[model samples]
Target: MAVIVTGASGFIGGAIARALADRDETVYALSRTDPEIPGVNFQHWDITEAAPQAVQSLAAKATAVFHCAGISSVSADDDALYAVKVTGTRNVLDAFPKARIVHVSSTTVYSSAEPHAELWEEAGPKDPSEFTDAYSRTHALAEQLVSRIRPDAAILRPAAVYGPGETMFMPFLSKISKKGVLRLPGGGRQKLTLTHVDNVVRAALACLDVPSAAGPFNIGDPTPYRLKDAIVTHFGRMGYDQVVIEGVAKDKALVTAKLGLKVKGVFKRGDRAKLFLVQYLQSDRTYNLSRQQRVLGISTTQHLIPSRFQ
Candidate 1:
C-alpha cells in the first residue's frame, strides 16, 4: 500500500514524507518541485489544478493523503495564497476521495486573545474575512472547506511549528532584530504555544494509522513559552551575543512598522497586513491538547527545539 504526501518540498511535509519512507512505507510525494527524498516516488502535482494521472493510478494503493501543501507566508499575494490554500485543497480532496485525509492546518484559524483559557477545538471556525493577514485568512477558509466536505478528515491545527527543518519560525524571529536590539510588542511577555514539527508529524501519522479517527486536533508543546524566553533561548544558543531584548506598546510598534509603502501615487503590496505580526506577538494564544493526548496518544513533552534544524 502507498501513502501520498503533498507539499513534500516544504519543511513540514518534507519531514513527514521522510519519516514515512524511513518506516518503510511506500510514499508517493506530490509537489511541483522535487522534495528529493529517497525511497519515495515523486509525482508532479499542481494542487490548484486537476490531480495528475499518476494520482488516480495510486488511489487504490493509497491509504492516506497528508494534505500539507499551502503558503505560510503572511506577505504572499492574497490571490496566490487563496489559489493554493483553498482551490488546491478542493483539488486534493477530489483526487483522493477514497483516501483518509490528514490535513495539516494552522492555529491561525481562530481569532482569540483570551487569557489563561485553553483554546478548545470548537472555539473557532472564525470567518476567514476577520483575519487581516493573507496566510491566516486563506488557511482558515481552506480549513472550513475541508470541514464542510470531509468532516471526518483528520485536521491537525498546530501552533507556530518550530523544530528540525524549520524555515519559518526562528528565521522570522531573527529578522525582527535590528542591530543589537530586539524589539517586540509587549516586551515579548505574552505566552505563545509553539508546536514542534516532529509532534505535528506524529499527529498526522497517528491520524493516518487510525483512518477511522477523525475531527480536529490542537497540536502544540505541553507548555507555552513566553515570547522573550523563546527569543532569548533561540538567539542565546546560536551564539548571538550582545543582543538586547526590548518590549514596546503595540500601538507604538504599529506606527513604527512601515506596513504598506507607496511609490509615486500607488501603494506597494508589501504585506498590507504587517500589523498582524505585531498583534500576534503581544497576544496570549495557547491550546488545549487533552483530546490529542487522549486520542492520538502522542505526548510532546520532549523534543521542544532540536539543536540542529535539518
Candidate 2:
C-alpha cells in the first residue's frame, strides 16, 4: 500500500514518513521544499494553492494520507494559515475521497484549564473558547472540515512536541543554559505536557490499520511537569548551573523593554513583550490520552526528560 504524507519536511511528518519506510511501506512525501531524508519519493507541491494536478493524480493511488501540514506559530500570516489549514484540507479530501486521513491536530483544542479524568473522546465540549491560540483555532477548523468531508478520518491531537531537531524550546533552553540564567515569564508554576517524537511516530503508525480509531484522540506523555522544573531539568542535564529568575517590580521595566524589542513584529507595539511572556510563563496546559490508549493501544513510557537529555 502506498502512503502520502503532507508536510514531510517538518519534524513530525518527516518522522512519520521515515517510520513507515522502515516498515517496508511505500511512502510518498509532499512538501514545498525537498527534504534531505532518503528512502521516500519526494514531490514538490504547494498546499496553499489549489492541489497540484500531479498531487491530485497521485491521490487516487494512495492507500492512506497523513496530513501533517499546518501553521503552528503566532508569527505566521493569518490568511495564509487559514488557506493552508482549512482550504488545503478540503482540497486534499476532494482529491482522495476514499483514502484514510490522519489529520494531525493540537491538544490546544481543549480548554486551557485542567481537564477532568472523564474527559475522553466525544465527551469534551467543542466550544471555541476551549482553544488558546489562533493556531489551535485553525487546526480545529481543519479537523471539522475533515469530519464533514470524511467522517471516518482519524484525528491525532498531540501535545507540545519536543525531541531532537525541535527548534521551539530546545534552542531557547540551549541559550539560557549557556548563560546560566533562566527566567520564567511569571513564577513558572504552570503545568505543561510534551509529546516525544518517538511516541508520536508510534501513535501515527498504530492508527494505520486500527478499525476503531476513527475519531479525535489526544496523544502525549501523561506526565505533567511545572515549567520551572522542566527548565531546570533540561539545563541541569546539559551540565549547567541553572538559576530561575522571576520578574520583580524592580526588574519589570527592564523585562518590559526586552520583550518589546523581541516581539514587536508579532504583537502590537505596546504589549508585545507582555503577550509573548504570558504564553510561556502564565499558561497551564495539559491533556488526557486515555482514549488513544484504550482505542489505539498506544501509551507513553518515557519521562518528559529523555535519557539523552540527561
Candidate 3:
C-alpha cells in the first residue's frame, strides 16, 4: 500500500512526504509542482481540477491520504478558497474513499476577531461566515465536510506553522524588517501557539499508526511563544545582529491594517500581509496541547525545541 500526500510541493506537505520517505514508506506526492524530494515520486495535481487519471490508480493501493493541497491566503478570492479547500476537499474525499484521511487544517478556523489570552482544545467558531477573510471560512467549511463524511478521520488544526520554507509568519518577518528595526503589534507579546514542521509531521504520521489519533486534534510545540521572541530567534539563527524589535499598540496596529486594506489592489497580498501581522502579533491564541500529548504520544519530541528557546 502507498501513502498519498497532496500539496507535497508545500512546506508542511513536503516535510510530511520527506519524513514518510525517510521511514521507507512508498510515497506518492501530488502537487502543482514537484517537491523534488530524493525518493518521493511526484505527480502533477491541481486541486481545482478533478483528480487526474494517472494518479487515480494509486488509490486502490493507498493506505492513507494527507489532504494538504490548499493555500491559506487571506487575500485569496472567497470563491477560490472554497474551490480549493471546500470543493477540492470533497474531491479528495471522493477519490480516496478507501484511504485513511488525514486533513491538515489551520488554527485560523478558530474565531479570532478579539484577543484570546488562553485557547484550548475545542471547536473555535460556530459560524465561520462571520470571518472577514476567506482563509478561515473556507477551512471551516472543509472541516465540517470532513467531519460529516468521515467522522473517524484524523483532522489536524495546527497553529501558525513556522519553520523553513514557510510562506506565512516566516516571510512576514523577513519582508517587513527594515535594516534591523522590526515593529510589531502589541509589542509582539502575543503568545502564539506555533507548530514546528517536525511536530506537525509527527502528529500526521501518528494518525496513521495510532488508533487514538482520531477526531480533530490541535497540534503545536510544547509551549506558546511571544511574536517578538520568535522573530528575534529566527533572524538570530540566520546570524543577524542588532535587530531592534519595536511594538505598536494593538489599537494602532489595527488602524494601520485597516488603512492598508482600503488601498485598492496595489499589492494583491497586501491585505493578507497587514491583517496577519496585526492578528499574529496582537492576539493571544495559545492552546492546551495535553490532548495531542496524550493521543499522539508527543513526549519524545519535547527535546525538539531550539537550544536558544530552551
Provide the RMSD of all predictions against the true structure, rounded to 1 decimal.
3.1, 4.2, 2.3
Show model 3 residue runs off by greater than 4 Å.
239-242, 265-270, 300-310
TM-score of each: 0.91, 0.82, 0.92
Model 1, 268-302: lDDT tens digits are 44444345676676568888989788888878754
Q: Weakest 10 consecutive residues, lDDT, candidate 2?
A: 270-279
Top candidate, metric TM-score: 3
lDDT per residue as tens, model 2, 98-119: 7888988876565544432334
Candidate 3 lDDT tens digits, 1-310:
8999999988889999999999999999988899999999998878778888987888899999999888756677778888899989998988888789999998887776765555665656447777777788888889889988998798998887777777776666777778878777767777777787788998988987885477778888886776677767766665545468888888888877877877645765455667766765666888777878788776424323457657
* TM-score, prediction 2: 0.82
Q: Whose lDDT is higher: candidate 1's or candidate 3's?
A: 1
Best-to-worst TM-score order = 3, 1, 2
Question: Stretches of candidate 1 above 4 Å error?
Answer: 112-116, 238-242, 258-269, 302-310
Error of 1 at 297 (Å): 1.2
Evaluation by lDDT, superior candidate among 1 and 2 = 1
